[model samples]
Target chain A: MTDDTDDIKGTPALDPVISDSVELRLARQIRELDREMMPERDLWTAIERNIADYPQRKPFNLQGDWMPYGVAASLIIAIAALLVNVVGLEQRNSTLLAADYAIDSIDSGYVNVRNPMVDQFRETNKNLDQATLDDLYRNIEIMAQARKDIEMQVRANPENTKLVEMLMRVHERELELLKQDYSQPGRSL
Target chain B: MNRALKATLSGVLLAFVWAMPCYAAVDSGDLAGKRVDLSEAAKPDGFVKISIVRGDLIVEGWDKDEVSLVGTLDEKTEQFIFDVSGRDTRIIVKIPSNNTSWCCNEGSNLRIMVPKGSQVDVATVSTEVRLTDIRGGLDMSGVSGDVRIQKVSERLRVRNVSGEITVHDVDAYARIKTVSGEIDARSIKGGGAFHTVSGEIVLRDVTDEIDVESVSGDIEVIGRNISLARGHSVSGDIDLEIELIDDALVEFDSVSGSVRLRLDGKLNHKFDLETGSGSIRNRITDDKPKKSKYIRDEQLRFTVGEGDGQVNVSTRSGDISVSK
Candidate 1:
């Protein structure tokens, strides 16, 4: 009709074709073919049977978890540390008791013998200068401190005979100083 | 001031001065004096034994062939008896029992002179004993008075109670002991043993084997060319400065007392040192210390040079210091 399709430059032009009976005949042949199909057995019943035979799984419980094993291990370590501390303390206490007994027995006899000599020395040297007296007192204090240190060591090592002997020696030295001071001929004068 | 008042004051001052007794000069002329001489009939190498009670006793050695005794007797007591029988001579200065009670206040001061190379033995109570220029063995004991010996050339033994002992220029073995006094020994050649309780011991320039022990008293030894030395103390510090001879062995032990040792810089020795509850200061070698805990005990085992000499030191609750 009015030549609605125009030929464009540098393009190929289309050719029009008339309607044919071949299309009608092919559509009529498809309508004649079978459209319905069926399987040989029911697949829903097999799925149901397989599901019934499957094994069941258990539910999760937090009470029976692995945390108790960790707690048990920690408890064992704590008990071992405590036992070690207790044994050490007992040994230390026993040593202290033994030391105290030994020291006490020796001190009584030594003090009795030292007192009179000390008194005599003090009376004889009553006229000495204050500085000399102070120096003597200071030395005595040092000796006392040394004695205390030895006693402490003895307490830690009760069977240490050397410590006991040293303690006695310190006592004797204190008395000797008092005696020697006044025993010199010109000292009292 | 008025003349009368001045005169009165002067008189008072003179009387006061006269009333104050002189305490410096002691007079012994009032006491009796005697001397006894024995001929060479008393052997030159014989023994002289003396026993006295109170006052000073002086024994001297001379180049004589006879034994002589000069006694200063107390007017209140009997004269000393001299028995020169056999090869030994005995002198007895007798004192009354009451006079012996007072120390250094009674008894005759005997001066006995003997020949060289003569053995001498003296025993006294409450009296000072002095021996000089002796060339034989000496044995002396005293109570409550000082004992002094000088220039002895043989074995010497002295024991005392509550008195000082002083020895100088001794060239033989010596054994000295005191109970509550100081011991001062110098220039000894052949060393022996010295012990004290509650007294200080000072030994200077001693050689050969020496052993010293003390309780509650400090000990100091300073010398050179010492071959073998051992020192022990309880609650008393020990100080040693020595030059070790070849193959010398030195040991020191203490309990609650510090031990200090100074050796010659050129010494070649092996040191075995240990301390409990104490620290050690070693300036002898560069060897490291062993592992310890609690008390921090210092144990040192090391050798210097070829380790020809040995030094062992141990202490408890005290310090040990070694230096070159």
Candidate 2:
């Protein structure tokens, strides 16, 4: 296993080559640095032995000690992108936690301000023809299921801003649907 | 046993059994259609209202200052109300409010001709409303009925529960919404907003602005000259092939759905694209996506040309494809 995993292979990246402005800036900064002085001690063989135990974990293909600053800048940009979308619906978290939590704190703070007529439509409104009524119910169920499935996806990818935005959009759809009496047409829509 | 009496009783029983199905048929299906034909004078820029249960409505606009309604209502229809007051006209066909699926078949077939500039409003349960050559505005809503309309030159608003809506040749602001029904429109010469759930949306050559939202439905837009666009979906893919103006604001968001943006003409927008658990493939500009060392997310932030406008696209578990 150690011999097979010694040369950690890199999978073909699905994205375009990572050469954005920040990366270019960081690359320029890296080029300006001089060769680092030798450390007091080096434990390359011990690190290799420890890596043999966990052959599944692949190290990030990053070079130089300045990589941490680059990562921080990227994280800042990502968070800014997220804040542009779900500021009202999302609960603000000061720090990013470990990946151990199954669901995000935003899920608890997010409440779907349902349409007041949703319960009425689910319970009453028998005057509608069967086909239309059935379609309505099926759609309601579909929307409910869609909401659930999206919440599950949010739980899985807590750092995904698009998923959170998608969840809020589903809630907005629910609100729009609730404000309607499907049996009647809007004279002034 | 009395043989004559027993024979007579058996014949009566058989006759009663045979007649039961005929009575049931008469109660349900065999209904005569009630005909309605009426014409009233009205203003050119007046108001017209129509209501029906279910059927095909063929409504058009004429140059004359009159509203003519000709149709056959269901025999089970309780009332046919056609009234014209001043410049307003109302045509309503009423039936028993509580009805089963087998209540009406091929419902009312109405052909209405209104004035050229009449703002018409229609409501129905399961009726396919078709409007054509109406120079004014149209506001209509229904449930489970497909809508087909054309040649409107004003604000057009349509809402449906589970029916497909198709619009052709509109020259004003339009807002069309549906649930579980596909929306297909073309040649819109103004700002347009279309929304649906579990239905695909397609638009072509719509100019001023475009806003679309969907769930579990794909959105494909090919516009000639677009200034602003906003599209959001969950589990629905979005494909936009557009030519933007100088100041364009394009934003797209999705979860578990891919977004493909193909641009044409001179570029002057900043691109802020990201994807989680997915990859961003940028082919339009020299700026490439930057991958995060922590998670499976990539971000591409760059300016194309002078960057006069903004273009943001994000997806979770979905790919982002940008091409020129």
Candidate 3:
């Protein structure tokens, strides 16, 4: 039954390519290493096998030198790496958060500066002479600005027609004021 | 002998045949240079009936026997025929409508010369009616056409729909009405009632009583010399420039529109103006007390020029401005 279950020959015949790629290269590299600096996996495996031979498991009285050294080294290296990574990650995250806050503030500031009505008012005011024009130009400017602002508000709530009509009246009043101002004396073109 | 020469010959024949009738119509239908003079025609009754459908009617008084109807008709099928009937009392110009669509689609314009003090009744559809220098009463009505009368005597009544009405130099009483159009009449020697719905009414240089009402258009009057004036609007402004004569009662009201009164500062009158939360600007600058109250109190009851005229104004959701 054992012979029938065997799927391979009793001799260990292997491919030279696979042996050189994996087993031979790893074994040769381990042999070249210094004796005091042995690989940790072989030592750990031997200690586990010896401990398991006891009938009832008892705590080992002898100090395992390799175990303590390996544990202490790994613990120290991990703690140091963790501290470094935590500090680096916190710094990067805070910097990103501050940049996002600054960008948001700048975006709001730009919106205030480019308000369409205010810009048109300023352009109209430059050509106005207050003493001669009376409150005509200023009223017109304010009315135009109010209309634009109301239109912008309606973009969000489109059913608000009353506000839109009020703005239209303001625009009409501005035109009336302009026409009345044209008939005044000492008024320039 | 060649194909190109044969094609050129056919093209020449076609051009010559089509151009002959067009050139012949211009010679026969030329009215301006031709001397079709009318002898002195007399209408002793001083009455005329003008029947028009689609043409500009320009009428003036003339001392002649024949009423000259000069027009250039595009279609030979539609005759420019006018049958003048009645003896000396009355004359009627009628053109039969049984023929094809005689509407000179470029449209037609009339320059009729009636006798002095002649009455005119014109009915039109889609053409401008301009009557000037007539010493008679006018009854005009139309659909989709403008009526402009300048320097006319006797009573005037005009009814139009969907067209502008402009009457200048009206020496008698005038009553004009329109729907969805503008009314601008000026320099009236008598009072008139002008009404429009959904249209603006502007009256200037008026010397008579006026009753104007609009649904959604402004009512503006400048230089009015009337004993009583009233204007109403649904959603429009009421502007009045008054130089009131005698004791006048002026009432101006608007539902949701402004009221502006530009009156002569040298007059003496008591005025009452009311508005709902809108501002009141009194440019008259009279020596009157200014009081504040609940929704009302900005009233100026003052006297100017013996305090003969009484002015009242009211509005809702609009301002009242009184300027000198």
Best by TM-score: 2
Tens-place lDDT digits, model 1, residues B256-309: 789999997577889998888788888887776564865578888889878999
* Clash pairs, model 1 backbone: none
After superposition, the stretches of candidate 3 with alpha carbons farther than 4 Å from their true spots are A1-189, B1-40, B73-81, B87-104, B285-306
In candidate 3, position A159 carries an lDDT of 37
Model 2 error, position B183 (Å): 0.6
| Stretch of 10 with least lDDT, candidate 1 chain B | B21-30
Task: Please tell me which model should have the higher DockQ, number 1 or number 3.
Answer: 1
Compared with the true structure, the alpha-carbon lDDT of candidate 2 equals 0.79
Candidate 2 residue-wise lDDT at B243 = 90
* Candidate number with the higher TM-score (2 or 3): 2
> For each model, chain A TM-score?
0.46, 0.40, 0.28
- Backbone clashes in candidate 1 total 0
List candidate 2 segments past 4 Å from native.
Answer: A1-119, A122-124, A153-189, B1-32, B101-104
Q: Which rank order by TM-score, best down to worst?
A: 2, 1, 3
Task: Highest DockQ: give the candidate number.
Answer: 2
The most accurate candidate by lDDT is: 2
lDDT of 3: 0.60
- Models sorted by DockQ, best on top: 2, 1, 3
What digit string (tens of lDDT, one per residue) describes model 1 on residues A1-189?
Answer: 113223222226433331233345568899998897566777889888888897566665577765887699888877876666676666777667766887766666766776786687677645433433444455555555655666666666676665576567667656755564322221222
